[model samples]
Target: MIKAAESVGIRAEWVTCQNAGQLMKCDALFIHGTSSINHHTYRMARWAERERLAVMGDPQSIIRCTNKVYLAEILERAKIDTPATIVVPRGNAD
Candidate 1:
């Protein structure tokens, strides 16, 4: 991936993206997925939003695939109840 970037004269910087400090160095993020990230990464994503850098590709594809709650929300919104759900802490969140 870095090689492909270098081919186009674009410099790729790899850093420990724990927050805006990391994303602040880049102009954009072509996020292929979010399966490998933890909660801290979400904070970085929020920072990216605040910083106004472009985040490409389907973030949900990785996020929802890794997070059960998020995936459930997508399914529910699509009216596709693919899982047997029982929300113990179900409240008037909606």
Candidate 2:
């Protein structure tokens, strides 16, 4: 992805935990890893958005996509077929 971006004359750098501080210098952020609300990638995305940097996998999307129950509800409402699913409440999984 870096190579492709550079090919188009768009300066890009791979940000990792070691060099995440460099994110402040970037014009945009493209996360290339798994993202969840409790993960570092999510924090990075949130920070990027807070700093007004263009970001893929924005915080809101991450929040919505990471919650399985929310996704199930959305799919069901949209009439999208899915395998049988049961959402058992925590501590009530008897």
Which candidate has the highest TM-score of all?
2
Candidate 2 structure, TM-score to reference: 0.85
lDDT of all predictions: 0.62, 0.92
Which residue pairs come into collision in candidate 2?
Answer: none
Best by the lDDT measure: 2
Model 1: CA > 4 A from native: 18-20, 31-37, 57-63, 67-94
Task: Estimate, for each residue in 32-86, the C-alpha lDDT of model 2 and write its tens digit.
Answer: 8999988999999999999999999999999998899999999999999999889
lDDT of 2 at 14: 91
What TM-scores do the predictions have?
0.50, 0.85
Tens digits of per-residue lDDT for model 1 on 31-85? 5334344654555555565678776533444465776777777788899957587
Task: Give the deviation of candidate 1 from the true structure as CA RMSD.
Answer: 6.1
State how far residue 31 of model 2 sits from its true place (Å): 1.3
